[model samples]
Target: MLHGQSNAWAIDYDNVYNDNNLPEDAHWVRTIGAMHVYNRPAMYPEAENTNWYVASGKAPDIRGGIQLVGNGMVGVLGLNIGLNLVASQNVPIAIINGAGGGGAIASYQKNDSGLNAAYGRLQHRLEASGLKLHIKAFIWNQGEGNAGDAVSDYKNALYQLYKNLSSDYTFEKFYLVQTPPGCSASSGHQTVREAQRQFAAEHLAVKIITRHGFPENPLFDGNYFLSDACHYHAHGYEMLAEWISNMAKYDFYNGTVDYQAPQLVRVIRESGKSLSIEFDKPIAVQPDLKVDGIVYSVKDQLFAINSKKIISISELKVDSKNNKILRITFKGKRLTKGAVITYVLGDTYPDTKEPYRGPWLVDADTGVGAVGFIKTID
Candidate 1:
């Protein structure tokens, strides 16, 4: 099952977008949806003939909700997952979307908001398919709604939500996609992100896949979308599904896949205007990394510091002697006392065009992208 907000349902969820990147056998694997965004197999007529018709469910009330008509539609995430599992594990599967957009973590809980009537919707879908007791896992992409909430509160609420969800369906594992950046409601984008990290760490069954590695396309065919910073395009959603399915394949069926990415674990202040970021593994710089809000300063704010600021990057590269520690040297002033750093640092990305913003690193050998982090220096 797929869960969470717009990022999960997909902002650019046009049938063309979904069909453009689907695997060959997607339609053969049956699928369905909760209420908000259900699946149809029009793309693969074979699947419709062999499986489900579009469910007669009510459309959700989201800012950009796709108006449904008699025409059929395909789920960008589900069919991709189905095809991947079939190709690799040789097992057929059906995916369900239980997610609704514009909802915070609290809203999706047992009895919080009407949107979570999705829980009831989910129950109905499963019963209709005769799989109320045969669910395997839940793949999710959320947290933007809870970005403004207190970190600790978000943590407990998300945990409770998980426990509550487990009560309704007997699913075994949970797959969480790390929420992408850009929440204008508050600057707490990183706060929600950190809380998600902690939640995944605390739960053994929950596996986290990073969305920051792919490209973020705010515009579809030259149209600018508000979802630019946070939501990804069809390609982005496709990669996310691929990651989730890959990890699920490895986790559930003992298939071997390299879905793990390099993670930032430590940060060190090297003497004089330099900082060293340590990753879990040796890092490889695939492209230039641009970060936001950098300044050189002294131990105290009272002291006069270098006036030059890092609006753009000076240089972000791996140190010659150390593959694990990426050394960054700022222009002009030395970084000292009271200084901090952040990632993808501006309102707009004027640099690279890769999906998601820069500051993206990866495992040197596997090329698996590194996880984008919170305000933490690493």
Candidate 2:
């Protein structure tokens, strides 16, 4: 299902998978791929298992066009992942060994480091290739390694990761896997989960996939997880994958946009003569409008109202219900009942949140204190 212009490659910094597991006759390794780069696992296994059969070597220098493979979690370190991502244009999807017993921190560290590095690489490449990379969604599930003091860092770590990804990816959309239940809501894992929610709330881009109300014993038994208490034994991973895929396929705001009322509304008056504006809440005009453009003289006033920009208002109506009025610039002007006037507002400049001023204005009505509407809006 990996559709692109490159072959799959496995880079293992964790030593989670080895050559013995992928010998010429080894089914899993051979079937997986031939390009494998094994690194010393940040934390190697206690008693070697069937999976850790590969040997570590001088890591390969991945240039580009390579896909990544690993166990479920990654997103901790920056360098290893950065390199992995640099080796490929397609965002790397890793599959790690799911049986490690380090609790939340272990999995989180590995998964987070890998994911973050990949994102960083994607950002750099997108910038160079003139391509825009956006995160449509995410699938995260980890909790075993987060049992103690290491737990406090979990939430912030995840939040920071999200912040970095959103900034680099230019898209904030993501999906969060709730920490599995039955681990006592007061546990460190639970603490991290709460932090995750707080982070999601502060940003408009993240959504938590509900693992709440999930039956414990009965459901686990019915779902085949009864055999393995820690990780998903039977159909859990499949079910989880299906759920994540469904969410990722659709817009994250599928049914949640209506609940959020617009908050920040602003207007830019290039000519400084416009005072008409709009926002989620009303705003007052500056007593004296002043906007400096590339080449222009004469100070003009501007205001944003109801998320719209208005110009040349003699005065404004005070609304206490909405603390909006800031200044009063338009007053004591000639009365032109319906005579049109023109004013300029801000312009959209890339990489800057600041709106630029445009001296040009269209047909706008003039009046002693008339509110001129925005003729052309960006």
RMSD of 1: 7.5
How well does model 2 score by local distance difference test?
Answer: 0.32
Q: Model 1 compared with the native: what TM-score?
A: 0.72
Residues 1-378, candidate 1, lDDT per residue (tens digit)? Answer: 777776666645343443445456555566553335332212222222223643211223244434421112235565567667888777777766666565777656666332226555555556667776778888767887776566688778888888877776777778777665555443435556666777887888776667655543445532223344555455666677777787777778886765755666776767566677787778776554333342221111111122222543355678788898787665654666445444332222334222234435666755556654443342
Task: Output the TM-score of candidate 2.
Answer: 0.35
Error of 2 at 207 (Å): 0.4
Task: List runs of model 2 lying over 4 Å from the truth.
Answer: 1-132, 149-152, 170-172, 182-188, 213-223, 252-378
Candidate 1 collision pairs: 214-355, 215-355, 215-356, 216-355, 216-356, 292-345
lDDT of 2 by residue, 126-223 (tens): 34333236433443444434533232476677766556545555544555554433232232233444455445556666655433211222343233
* Strongest candidate by TM-score: 1
Q: Which candidate gets the maximum lDDT versus the true structure?
A: 1
